[model samples]
Target chain A: MARAQWPLQHGRPIIEIVLTLAQGAQKVTRRLLADTGAGAMHDPFDIVLDEVDCLMCGGKPSKMVPLGGSYSGTHPIYVIPIGIPSLGFRDSLFAVGVAAPPAGFDGIACFRFLNRFTYGNFGNANEFALET
Target chain B: MATATSIQQLNRDLADKLVEEAKLDLPSWPLGKFVGIANGHVIVVSDDLDEIVSQLERAEPDPSRTFVVEPGRDYTKVCEIWRIS
Candidate 1:
């Protein structure tokens, strides 16, 4: 199984993923909140990014997303590549650009993103992983 | 871009205004076209995001507080847009 696992660094199951934003540039890693209850079919966003990060990464919107919950407006969506080194997984997915990201995360990995893999501790409650 | 520093320190009121302002003007443009706004003013309105950004680069030197969006797409509901603040 292709799996990427990490301990709950902030007492939460956050994942360390790298974004391939600029070619031949420094590796950009972002810690995202693994929110299993944070997405719906209406929401095409698989992940989230703050405006600065999004723009710095040259994130451009292919779609307009209306996010409910703490965010309430139409935001930009980008198809950015993500890498989970632990799993040796690299692929691109939809990311939403928002203004006020939560307090403790660079971004969020919503259910839509997680649904792509089999994720959980797989037995170790102190850690998390994406089993593919 | 680090969670160690929250974007809450930014001008949230201005950010909200930009998005709201863009939404209000969405109908005036063609569907599927992209719109870019920055510093509380509409900067680039074009057919795609690339064109918008290209025009935006010259229009707004500092686009850290900009908003870009497209029309005629599905509405996504974020059950939780936040982690634990």
Candidate 2:
């Protein structure tokens, strides 16, 4: 069976986890469009976990914290901070607020997500493959 | 009219434009902020943090406009993009 788990060592620190890929998940990310200071921005991406993927019941939600800012506005936002692992890439442990489901169970992948895998695109096939 | 767009709108427009640019060369996400236009140079911010920052520092940017990126967002919680010559 294909493995859904991976282990990594970051600067002498080792961590591991098992991940499940589902379809129709959405990825929320922040990109610098204008002169925004470094560290000035709060959580750039927030990913919401799907019910199927979310085995936790009572209050085990993708806990979101308020990142004070005028740009963030009055909107109340939350995020589920977790570690993500991919094949052939480094491990990513960032808080991804569960927004919506992804198109595929492959789960929502982001730039940080990119860091967790060996990524490349083939000609017209228009598909991405990853392994861990 | 204010002639200014909302952050959401700006992000959408930027995403579309950058995605198109990526077709030629995979454009980096969030080409920083478009602070103000001046001296014909479009000042860009450096969004990379930690190690990425170091990597970007060692590399050269497009020669035309010298993009200046403050380490992190300013006290305003926004980065300043100053146009260059």
Which candidate ranks first by lDDT, i.e. highest? Answer: 1
Cα error, residue A116 of model 2, in Å, equals: 4.9
lDDT by residue for model 2 (B2-85), tens = 222343244334434433554464233333322211122223333422232223224422111111221221212321112211
TM-score for chain A, prediction 2: 0.34
Q: Which stretches of candidate 2 lie over 4 Å from their true place?
A: A1-48, A51-92, A103-106, A115-118, A124-126, A130-132, B1-85
What digit string (tens of lDDT, one per residue) describes model 2 on residues A1-132? 122322221211112224322233333222111111212223333222343343321111111233232122222111222333433322212332233333332233333343344433323233333334
Scoring model 2 with DockQ, what do you get? 0.02
Task: Write down the C-alpha DockQ for each prediction.
Answer: 0.19, 0.02
A1-132 in candidate 1: lDDT tens per residue?
Answer: 788887886788877889755435567889988888677643557788886776666554344667666678778776455678878877655688888677878888888878889999999999988888
Q: For model 1, state the Cα shift of residue A10 in Å.
A: 2.8
* Native contacts recovered, each model: 0.38, 0.01
Could you give me the TM-score of model 2 versus the true structure? 0.27
Poorest 10 consecutive residues by lDDT, candidate 1 chain A: A56-65
* Candidate achieving the largest TM-score: 1
